[model samples]
Target: MKKCCVLIPYYNAGDTLLSAINSIDYDYLHPDVIIVDDGSQITKAADVLKEYIGPLNIILLEMDSNKGIEHALNYGLSLHGRDYELVARLDCGDLCKNNRFSKQVKFLDENPDCYLVGSWVDFTDMDGRKLYTVEHPSDFESIKKLMFINTTFTHPTVIFRSNILDSVGFYPTDTPAAEDYAYFFKIIKKHKASNIKESLVNCTIDPHGISTIKRKRQIKSRILVIAHNFSINKYAVYGIIRSALLLYTPRGFTVFLKTFFNPNR
Candidate 1:
């Protein structure tokens, strides 16, 4: 079997870290689970993770102070050798479906030219009960609909070839909120990309997560993404304005009614 490693970046996620770790059924696909501790103040996370340290090759990289997710991910990437073909990502507070790694690895093995592969996800509550499903777009056009909006790919469910990182480099540290989206724009829009049309992962969302609280930051980062990808000329401006009015309209009777009635929304 080809080697794969699960790279998890941790902060103050002591509350849900162990459950995320345990949810990975290592018996089926024993990938090296590397946890990059991004200066988590929650000391109990260390104790909880210690219990499972011996059973798996759990490598922990601790930073003296809290750097952001990009730093932690770069640190994790630095620890691995060139032997590993695939690097899988999971956030600290998220859980992976039982066969997440198995299915992704199989897809990559069959599709040699494909650099990155992401799966559809079912969003769940903190208790791990299913709330709703987020379907992924099957082709490039449908995926482009997410240039301003980010409904195409769930970050945690993505697995990419290590070489792509070598080519495009690590996640952007500058744009903190939409770093993943910015990276996707560079890789998929600038370069070429592909996705597998399979629902292979479950994404858990904490209602009070940082991503939700920092809405303005996320929107600002997205604006940068638009500026970087599209030319600031008249034609691009018109396209962006149309997309913004269609996609980013506030939650109101009109917006909700349109989304509710539209099959794609």
Candidate 2:
């Protein structure tokens, strides 16, 4: 099978960065793991690179200052993206399940029409306690419809074709905290997208992570995404209502409601 690259944005990731890097099945993926350091002054990503020994090609790109994840991601992709046919994403703390990269690459390779593929993820607490699993739609039609409500692909669980950049471009800075939501929405509208039917990664739920810290901004951004991609349909109307409603609710409530009704999870 052909090789793929992985994009990881790190800022004060500490040991979780190591866990994320170590989880990749290097031999199978033969990954060019590009890590962008978003000015991590404390508990740096470089600290892990210094002590590690591995077969995977781990490239580190350091920005002059902190510009947030969107900038770091685009920086990495702008320079390293074209060299590979596929790009996979993993956050600093997420652990790739066995055969995750291989399976994703193989799926994209065999199914030429599918531009993006993600997997269900296992969410865990800081102590590695199981929180919940998020299962996304596996069919293109369902994904396109459900995306109106929320992003179907968990960012960390996705591996997408590089050429889609030609159609959809890089992650949009305008989306603020919900760039992936907007980007994935663009792809599904233009091409087929789906998820593998099983959990392919373990994503630790960081209480102070960007999703939590910028919860409100993300929800507002989701509003913009939904409005911009608006179409007249039952799911679309309900999606707008759900996202707008989420803006008023606390993050805990939204998380609880989603977990309680995970839709065939």
Candidate 3:
């Protein structure tokens, strides 16, 4: 069996932490779970995790100060050498489907050339009720369409090969909000990437989440997206124009616009 582990970077999640952990059905693919607390102010977050303590390798590494997600992720990755073939990412508030790890592991095992693998996801409200499902591309050509806009391949649903980290390096610390987007562009440009075409994760859309509330972060993310990915003047100009327009519209409207204008869509 291929060795795999799930890395979760959490901050002030409180009771939601256990739900995230429990959502992954480890019985199918028994992978180690590493949770790094990113200076959460809530004391109960730590205490709540204690309830689910058992034989599982649920290691908790706490940081004294908030180091941001990139720092927390890099810290988690530093724990293991090259023994593990795959490293799965999970967020503190999101939940993985029952066979998420098992399916991702099997996909990686079969498709050795692919460095990164993600799955489709269902967006849910804070109450855990499903809002709608997101379908992602499964092949390389379709994956390139992702450059035009980000469809739902929630960060938590992605499982990447460990060696790719050596080539791409850790997530760019300078760009916190769109760090994953930056990292994905690097991987797709340099290595083979694809999605599983299966809905294997439930992404919670917390109304108060940083991704939603922080407008400046989203604007900053657009700048990073153009700077890191599109080096050509034409492509960069196009990306900049599109990103500016995207910022003004609601996310739902932006998605619809992309779907209508995008050639692949």
Candidate 4:
């Protein structure tokens, strides 16, 4: 079987980091799980890491000071773990089903044309109550079509081939909150990407998460991503126009529209 490594970047996650690690059924996939401490503000996260006891071969890397998610994720991706055939990602507070890595690896193995694969994701509240499930297009063509509108893949729920990282490069250090969206646009242009029809990961919707707290910044970055990567077409034009319009609206109103139109996302 091919090898895969799990990469998680955390910052001030508290006990949720440990809970996230514990929730993974590592026995099934047997992949090395690497967690990076991106200069956490609280000792709880570091203390929890020190106390972790698990069968999975866990490697912890810590930075000197608090960097944002983009820096932490890029640092994790830069590690030697890329020797594995595939690299999977999970957030500090998300839960992966026992079969997630296995299923994603199988899909990649079967679909050689695909460079990245994300599964349908279950969104839950902080208490783990299911909010809804997000289902994205499973084929490359449809996935590309949706790219101009929004991110088709859930960053934390994705499993991508290792080789593509060198070609696409790491997450943009400058993009900050929209690093994943910008990076996805960069990769999807050169490689095929898709999403599985079934939900394989449960993503916790933390109101305090970077995407929530700095959503307007993320949106602005996304517009720039689309502007640079997309050709002058109807989808590109529409995306640029819509994103620019959203910029002037109140952040709360934009959040409301997103919740109403695409709550699962």
Candidate 5:
């Protein structure tokens, strides 16, 4: 496999960051890892990095202030992504499947037209119990259609070509919590993107995370993303209605629906 590294944005991640870094099967891919500390006040998160002794290089960058994850991610991209062929993403509390990087790297190597690629993810609880799985459409057409209503790629399960960022630019910081959605929207229009059929990551759905705590803002930003990408078409309406329900209804209800009626399952 070509040289690739993982880029992780850290902010008060505590031990989760260390655990996440350790979980990657470095012996298989031997990709260097970079974690940009986004002005985390919690010292433990930063302190734990000192304990990671591994075969792969671990680059830790620091920011003086909390500038949000979008900026932190862009900071990492600007700093180190230029040298690697691929850059994978793994959030603080996420666990990668043993073959995650190998599969993603192989796919990127084989498909040069694909700018970015992601895989299915399993959403788990604090105790690591699987709650539900999110599987995205693998074909570009299905992904584009679904992008209006939902995020087609799992963020933590992605391994994108380095040039894709060069072409599309870094993640937009304007959207706050919805930067990934907006970034993907731009990517889908400019280049080919798809997901692997298998689940490659287990994401911890923290109730207090931005998705739950800032659902209203995220939904609003998603609606704006739809407006920017598609005109007033059927897909736009579907996007609005889907976002409206998530915004208006209680999160618990939406979680229930996702757990029980998730189309991928």
Candidate 6:
């Protein structure tokens, strides 16, 4: 088995989970995989993965109740720690570029001091139409500064040094939709993290929950994360103000802004 492990949290994704798995570049490394089911009734993890024809090392863990992604992630991490050096996150319907895993492992190996590294992501629609490209800062200093504003690492594009779990534990449960924001902040506070300059993942954005209610909860949780956040830098102060502004900013306006930045229509 390879030293890396891919963790996917599942919730009735149907064939899209296969799309995500098929994008893994097994040529570089067929790492161990763990799929955690978030009380999925319609699409059982076993049935969805039955047709998969790759290395037969995938492990499926099912939650009895619909606890949510945060719980599924923690459950997977707590049980799948079979001496992996790295843990990569992948979500259903997302596609990884061919060199995604190889580049992340190589980066971590070369820079032993770095505990986490994400890549730029190509955001797209279900029909594979490009929405926008998210390019975060590639260097550690820039990443640190940007974290004061928002999460630089998109969930599926990130690969973490497994030891960070030993150091920081699992994702924070109270952050609601912004659990990832708080989770990364806790780690960035202690370890060096960066992003690859180039896009290595196709992150499919679902427009289902982009409503006022959901966006308010997410922005509120993010503001909480930034307010309790520890930093003496001016960026931290600006971050609080920015998040507060986002709490009032309309989600549609932000979507329009991001769409305007999309190089592809």
Best by lDDT: 2
For TM-score, candidate 3 versus 6, the one ahead is 6
User: How would you encode candidate 1's per-residue C-alpha lDDT over 180-201 as one tens digit per residue?
Assistant: 8778776675443455665566
Stretches > 4 Å off in candidate 2: 258-265
lDDT for each residue of candidate 4 in 1-265, tens digit (9 for 90 to 100): 2488888888878778877787776766788887888897676356887778887878788988988888887787787546688888888889988488778888888999999999998877789977667787898888887789878999888988988877888888767688988888888889999988889899887889877778789888889888777886787888888888877776556545545677555
Estimate TM-scores for all models: 0.82, 0.95, 0.87, 0.91, 0.95, 0.93
Return the lDDT, model 5, position 233.
Answer: 65
Off by over 4 Å in 3: 53-55, 81-83, 231-238, 250-265
Model 4: how far residue 55 lies from native, Å:
1.2
Superposition TM-score, candidate 4 onto the true structure: 0.91
lDDT of 6 by residue, 171-255 (tens): 9999888888899999988999988888999987676632344778888888888888857888888888888888878776886
The residue-by-residue lDDT of candidate 3 on 1-265, one tens digit each, is 3488888888888867788888877787677788888887856356767788654578787888888888888888786625477888988779888588888888888989888889988777778876666778888877765564553256889999989878888887777677787778878878887778878988887767767776458666857776666655554577677777767767656444544564432
Candidate order by lDDT, decreasing, is: 2, 5, 6, 4, 3, 1
Q: Model 3: C-alpha RMSD to truth?
A: 3.6
Displacement of residue 72 (Cα, Å) in model 5 is 0.3
Q: Is candidate 1 or candidate 6 better by lDDT?
A: 6
The TM-score that candidate 1 achieves is 0.82
Model 5 misplaced regions, further than 4 Å: 262-265
lDDT score, candidate 2: 0.87
- Report lDDT (Cα) of residue 121, candidate 3: 82
lDDT of 5 by residue, 1-265 (tens): 3489999888887888877987797866799889999998866356978777767688889998999989999999998888898889989989998598888888887998998899988998889988789878999999988898889998888888888877899999888889999999988889999899999999998888878998899888888888778766677789888887777888777777788886554
The per-model lDDT (C-alpha) reads 0.69, 0.87, 0.76, 0.82, 0.86, 0.85
Q: How far does residue 30 in candidate 3 sit from its true spot (Å)?
A: 0.8
Worst 10 residues of 4 by lDDT: 251-260
Clashes of each: 0, 0, 0, 0, 0, 0
With a 3 Å backbone cut-off (N, CA, C), the pairs that clash in candidate 3 are: none
